[model samples]
Each structure stands twice: as C-alpha cells, then as structure tokens.
Target: MPYFAVLYDYAPGSDPLREHHRAAHRAYLNETDHGTVAVVATGPWSDGEPGALLVVSAPGPGELHAMLDRDPFRLHGAVAQRRIRSWTPVTGPWA
Candidate 1:
C-alpha cells in the first residue's frame, strides 16, 4: 500500500452542511480510520474553516478517489476543492 495525503477545501457558509453530516463523516472515518487501505488521520486545518487534511493508505489513485468520493461532506457540495497526492514517508512515529 501507498500513502496518499488529501487536502479538502470547502465552500464558505457551508458550516451547517458540515455539521449536518458530521456524524456520518466521523463514522465513516472511524470505521475505516487505519490499515493498509484506510484513513490514517484527519482533522480541520483551523477553527471556523472548512479545510481538512486526511492522510490515507490505498493501492493507488483510483482506490483513493473511490474512497474519498463517498465522503458525506463532498457528496453534499461542501467541498470546494480537493487535492490528493502520493507521499513517501522517510522517518517519524508514523514512518
């Protein structure tokens, strides 16, 4: 498996939308939060902002896309921008 870092930028005034889907979002993440093909860690970049960083593991880009495509926030038009990249960890607790 390879690591993929996902950056999600959401539209403004989407707070309500995000809150509405918070449970489902968290549930999904918690259910698949770690393993060979799952979300490694995720959270908001700052307060009162809809930006998030999700480090995940998957076989390739296709699987990554498929996994992220199901995000409740993204499905409801909360996400304005999404960037995914392959990452190579050199050293650290997560390495």
Candidate 2:
C-alpha cells in the first residue's frame, strides 16, 4: 500500500461546514483499520485558509480516488478542489 496526502482546496469561509462534518469524516478514517490507512489528519490550511488535509493510504491511484469518493465531506460539497498524488514522506511519524 502507498500513502497519499489528499488535500482539499476549499473556498474561503467554509469552516463551519467543515467542522459540522468532522465526526462523520473521522469515522470514515477510522474505519480503514485493515491496512488501508497509513496516516490521516484534518485541519485548516495556512493562516486560517479554507481547506483540509486528508492523508491516508490505498493500494493505488484508483483505490485512493475511490476512498475519497466515500468521504462524507466530499458528498456534502465541503471539498472544492481535490488533489491526489503519490505521497513520499521522508520524515515525521507517518514517514
């Protein structure tokens, strides 16, 4: 499995909606206990900018996209722009 840093580029002023879906979003991340998750974290971008980091793991690009599609926040339009790329962590805990 490979890890990916799924970044959601959201428009400004969407924090409330993002917080509202936090619980469901957390649930989804936790559900990936069978080696499907490498690492995961969520929070606003730099300087209170609107967006989130959804770093996790999948078998490949297809698997990653499928996982993103299942995210609750994705369904509710909390995510504006979704970026998917193969992640290589050189340091830190998940690295």
Candidate 3:
C-alpha cells in the first residue's frame, strides 16, 4: 500500500490556538485509522515553530483528501497550508 505525506504550515505565534485544539486534533488523528496502508507521525518542525507534519497512508489522493477533511484544524479553520503528496518508501517499517 502506498502512503501519503501531508505537511501543515501553521501561522506564527499560534500557540493558544494549538493548545486549544490539541485534544481535538489528536482525537481526529486517532479516529482516522492508518492501518497497514497509512501511518501518521507528527511533531514540531522546529523549536517554537508552528509547522507540523501529518503523515498519512491511502491508495490515492481522494482518500487522502477525505482524511484531511476530518482533521480538527480543518474543521476549525486553523490550518494554514495542507500539502498532500504520494510517497514511496524504499526502506523502513513498511518496507
């Protein structure tokens, strides 16, 4: 199964928003299961940075979009840019 990598670039100084949405965001990720086809690994892009990476898995773009639509940030209009791309892993757990 192919995977997808979605990068989210949040606006600067959005801590309060992030804090408020933390639980909901995490819950949203948990609700969308990656199973064997997908996995989500997230963390700050850098110290005090507002960027995050939302790694996902699916067969195609449609599936990816559907998943993104359910994300808490999207629902609350807090996400800045949501970039989606198809990924081919040459090595790692999935390999």
* Candidate that scores best on TM-score: 1
Q: Write the per-residue lDDT of candidate 1 for residues 16-95, one digit (tens) a residue.
A: 99989989988877784433468889999977566999999899998788778888888998899999989988899567
2 or 3: which has the higher TM-score? 3
- Model 3, 1-95: lDDT tens digits are 67777888875666677789989888778764543335557666877566778667777887778777777777776777888877788899765
TM values, all candidates: 0.88, 0.75, 0.81
lDDT of each candidate versus the true structure? 0.85, 0.74, 0.73
Ranking by TM-score: 1, 3, 2
Q: Which regions of candidate 1 fall more than 4 Å away from where they truly are? A: 33-36, 47-49
Cα deviation at 7, candidate 3, in Å, is: 0.3
Candidate 3 residues lying further than 4 Å off, grouped into runs, are 32-37
User: What lDDT does candidate 3 reach at residue 37?
Assistant: 38
Expressed as tens digits, the lDDT of each residue in 2-93 for candidate 2 is: 78877888745667876898799878767845345454665557776677677777788776777778778888777888998778887997
